[model samples]
Structure formats: C-alpha cells, structure tokens
Target: MSDALSEASDLSGDDSQDVMTPTELIAKLEEAWLNEKFSPELLKNKSEIVECVMEQLTHMEENLQRVRKGDVKASIHRMEIDRIRFVLSSYLRSRLQKIEKFFPHVLEKEKSRAEGDPSFLSPEEFAFAKEYMANTETYLKAVALRHMPPNLQTIDMLKAVPEPCLDSFVFLRVKERQENILVEPETDEQREYVVDLEEGSQHLMRYRTIAPLVASGAVQLI
Candidate 1:
C-alpha cells in the first residue's frame, strides 16, 4: 500500500492523479487546510472543504478498521493512521486557538474592532465559537449564583489569553531593507535604536520586535 500510494501518481498521464491510500488523501487534505487557515479570504467559505475532508477521514477510519480485522499485515499501518489523526487534530486546534483569540467579536458580545469588520472565520469556526460561548456562559452563571467561590470572580478569560502577536526569540531575515525604522524599547533605561535593514541579512530577535517589519514585507518570517 505504501508503494502504491507513491506510485499512484504515475498511473495517469493527465494532470490529475488518484490518491491510492488514506495516508495520501489525508496529507493532501492537511495541505489544503493549512492553506485555507493562512488565507483570510478563503476562510470565510472554507466550511464545505472542511466538512468534505472530515467525511473522508471518517470513511478512511472505517475502512482501516475492517482492514485491520481481516489482515494481520494491516496492523503495520496503525502508526500511519495515528500520525494522520494527530495532524488532523493539531490542525483543528490551531484554528480553534485563533478563533479563541478573537472570541469576543466572534461571540458578537463586543463591537467590531478589526479593520473593515470582516469575519476571519468559516462556518466550522463559528460552531466552535458557539461552543465556547456556551461553556463561558455556563461558568459565569455558576459564579454569579455563588455555586463557585467569590475568589474566582476576578478571573478574566481574556486576561489569560495570550496575545495573538508574533512569538518571541525567533529568527527572521530581512526581505526589503529600510532605514530609520523606529521601534519602542521594552525596558527602561534603554536607548532607542533605528533599524537599518539589509536584504538577505538574518537577525535573531523576538518576533514581536520584528512583526511590523514582517507585515510590511520588509522581513521574512523564518
């Protein structure tokens, strides 16, 4: 089956090729999901693609179970199945993390703060948001009713939520050089520094420090 999956593309001389195994299909689905996750324009209508991929995954799981019971050698594919499942789960969690970052607006409990007031989520994301809303509301109600201690009243959901900004301590390379780039200092008693970027020069800095440069295409995220 592994060999078949690798050789399946050569079976046809046309632009299209068949995926011979669940592994190959899941890999392709993961690629598409990652692409959709990064592109906001496609995210708005990504529900159909997500649903189709999920259905395919379910069918693959069912077929795998039958194969396992009928053939001893099929047990070798268990690792592959587990890996695919992990990838699928991680993909979903990554998207959910993003939705939770903007949960307030997604729940429609807050006014629009993003520019253009566009929805950066798909229908599947909206469902996840609804789940989050239900859980939060339930918790708040319990707290207000004194079912929980008053000590938990000061817990702010958003306060625990990490900033959706770039992470720290990541390396980045300059894509387009610009001089006189101003940056605010993070600590007291530190002098300000102007960025004199040069194309192709790599620098090891906190991602937050260079996030603006990345957004402006002056630097590349590595």
Candidate 2:
C-alpha cells in the first residue's frame, strides 16, 4: 500500500504538463474531502493550485502597471486586466464556495437572512456590510495588482502635474447642494464652501494625483 501510494504521488508530481480544467480541480478538491488517506496530499495540491493562480494574477498586475506607466496602451492593458479579473473572479468564487462549505453555519445564516427578510439588515447594517465587502475586495485587488509591472505612463502623468499645486491642495470638506437659479452668490459668506464627492471617487482622484505627489515628496497624506 505504501509503495502504491508513493508511486501515485510520484506520478502526480511528474505530470506537470497535465493542465487541470477548473472542473477537474474542483472535483479533485471534493475527492480530497471524502477520502481520508488522500486528504493531506489533496490539501497540498490545492495550495499548489492557488500558487499557480497567484502567478497568473501577478502577471496580470504587472501588465496593469505597464499600462499605468504608459509602457502599454490603455485599451490593451484594460483588456488584459479585464481578462485577469474574470479568471480571478471565477477562481475566487470557487474558493469562496469551499469556504462556505467549511463554514456552512455562518454562511447559511447570512444567506438565509438575505433571502428570507430582505430588510432584516437595517440601513446602517447594509451600509456597513457593503463598505466591509468593498474594502476586502479592494485589498484583494491591490494584492493581485502588486504582482504586476509598474506602468511607465503613470510617471509621465505624474510629471505633467505641478508639485506645488499637488502639495497645497488639502481635502477639507465635501457637500452636495442642488443648483438653485434663485439663489444669489454670497458676498460675505459666514459658511465655508464644502466640496461634495461620491464615495470611492475621492480615492480615485487621490491615486491619480496624490500618490505621485507623495512619491516625489511634494505632498503628504494627513
């Protein structure tokens, strides 16, 4: 039995060219769950699979960086990024399913509540959940992007913007006011001007401008 198991392991290790389809990978993982003797090796194989996925994610990230730097055209970079994102999303969905399987109680509870009482979560709870999920997703994206090469165009974009302007700009307040034709401009206003920005938009603007400025030592984030 030991010799047979050893031979099987060796065969698996040697078959590097055998590219596993996603379905095959999932089936292998499921098989690992059922067979106690195979579980350990299967777990190890899953890690290897995840590593392979990470490599692809890294390559995609490098391409995105190249686009950001202007080394690659925006359209091409975007397409590549989109492709990577799709594959990564698919893989993540599969991984999340496994996670759900492992934590069925927690996931089922959340899913049940989500299905049964659409309004089980208060507005605040919904907002919190959305923000939390968005933050987690962003973090994962950044991790994937870090593996990509830097974009050369980003440097040029950075060079185009003035250092002084970048440094002096401080985000103070944000407000939303409806356009009123009847309202006149205040000559001596007691109220300060408030700038309103959509969520995530400010961060996007900051990344485009502030990141480069900070890199050049022209701006600091408080």
Candidate 3:
C-alpha cells in the first residue's frame, strides 16, 4: 500500500532509494530494542520505527477482519501481529523504565536542548516525565523537604539520580568499516591506541569511544 511504503521510507532516514521491507523493518526494531537494552544510557528515541511497525500490524489486522475465524490465513496473521506487538511493547517499556530511573536528567536534557533539535523524549514521553516530576516534587516536599533549611529544600534531580555510565564497555559488531577509532586505556599505566574497524568485525570496547558509531548505525550492539 502507498501508506505503508511511505511509513517505511521514513524509517530509512536516508537512502530513500528504496522503502525498507517488512523483514528489514523488523530487523531495525530488534536492533533498537537490543541497543536500548544493552547500552548503559538511554539512546536516541526510535518512534518512527514504532510508527511504521504499527502500520504493518494494522494493515494485516484489517486484512484478517474479512477472513473467516477458522481460516488458516487468519491464524497466521494473528501470530504475526502478536509477534510485532510484543517487540513494539517491549521497546517502549524499556524506554519508560529508563525515563523513570533518570527522569530529572531526562527533563533537563529535553529542556536544555536547542530549538529544531530532535527530542530525546517523544511528546507522550514528555507528558509522562512532567507528570512524574510533579508527583515526585509533591511527595518529597511533604515527606522531607518541608523540614529542611530553605537552601536545602530544593532537590536537583540530576544529582539525585545516577548518570548513565558512558565508560562502560559494550560488545558491538561493525556494520560499516570505520578507521581510526580511539580506544582509551582503563588506567594511566597503559597508552591510548587507535584501531581501524573492519566491516563485519565484532569488538569489545568502551562505549564512549563508539557511541557515535552506534548512533550512526555503523555498528550494532549484540
């Protein structure tokens, strides 16, 4: 369908030469899900992938509505829908947990971001974060802040929550070959080194070094 093709194109983000097929689209979602799961910090949001997958599921469901209840095709369609639904729900749930864990930091990042920047939080997520922030403030004020000195009454959520550990090491597979990646030493006793990333090679390295590569889709976190 035209609508489905359009949605798929949006996910490509570049290389509009071809719309991503359902299989490739699902692969992209799985990549996002695993990257979010393994990364120490919340990664860039992938709402476009979510939207496109939803489109695929909806189209299939619509087709199934005309099929008989006992039809084998109907059963197959239901299984496919459920499969994609599970992945979509899990990906969203993972992001929400991270938001709750680092809400203050999430809000701070969103607020300080410049105009025209891609938001770290989707609109729905922004609302959730705001509501969570309000509730937290109310509870803290009643439970502890009211009794503290005026200067100490204010809580800095950034300081209250732990930051994502960028220095942590991650296992990644290079999707595209890259040259001259800097690998920082774990201690001062060792010297820093640079290495070329060959396409299809897997590496275990500190995340901070290849965070940009991960974002660019040059590497995938297994």
Better model by lDDT, 2 or 3?
3
- The residue ranges of model 1 lying beyond 4 angstroms of the native Cα positions read 1-92, 98-110, 139-145, 148-156, 159-169, 216-218
Better of 1 and 2 by lDDT: 1
TM-score to true structure, per model: 0.46, 0.24, 0.89
Q: Please give, for residues 1-222, the per-residue lDDT of candidate 1 as tens digits.
A: 767856655322233333334445555556545533442211233334345456655665777877737465666566666776676676677667666666655455323436665454665677788788668767776757356566765545555544444444555667687677655577888777877768888876666666556545466545
Error of 1 at 164 (Å): 4.5
The ten-residue window of minimal lDDT in model 3 covers 9-18
Model 2 TM-score (2 dp) = 0.24
Q: Could you tell me the lDDT of residue 7 within candidate 3? A: 65
- Cα lDDT of all candidates, in order? 0.57, 0.38, 0.87
The digit string of per-residue lDDT tens for model 3 on 1-222 reads 998777666553454355687788899999999898888777889877887788778778888888878998788879888988998999999999998988888898999999999998888999999999899989999999999999999988788889888899999999999999988887999999999999999999989999999899899998
Higher-TM-score candidate of 1 and 2: 1
Which has the greatest lDDT?
3
Tens digit per residue, CA lDDT, model 2, 1-222: 775555444333344466554444444433323321211110112444444445555655775665545554766756755755565455444434433233322233346664554342334333444555456446645766456566621222123322322223333111222221122224566443433343223212223323333333232222
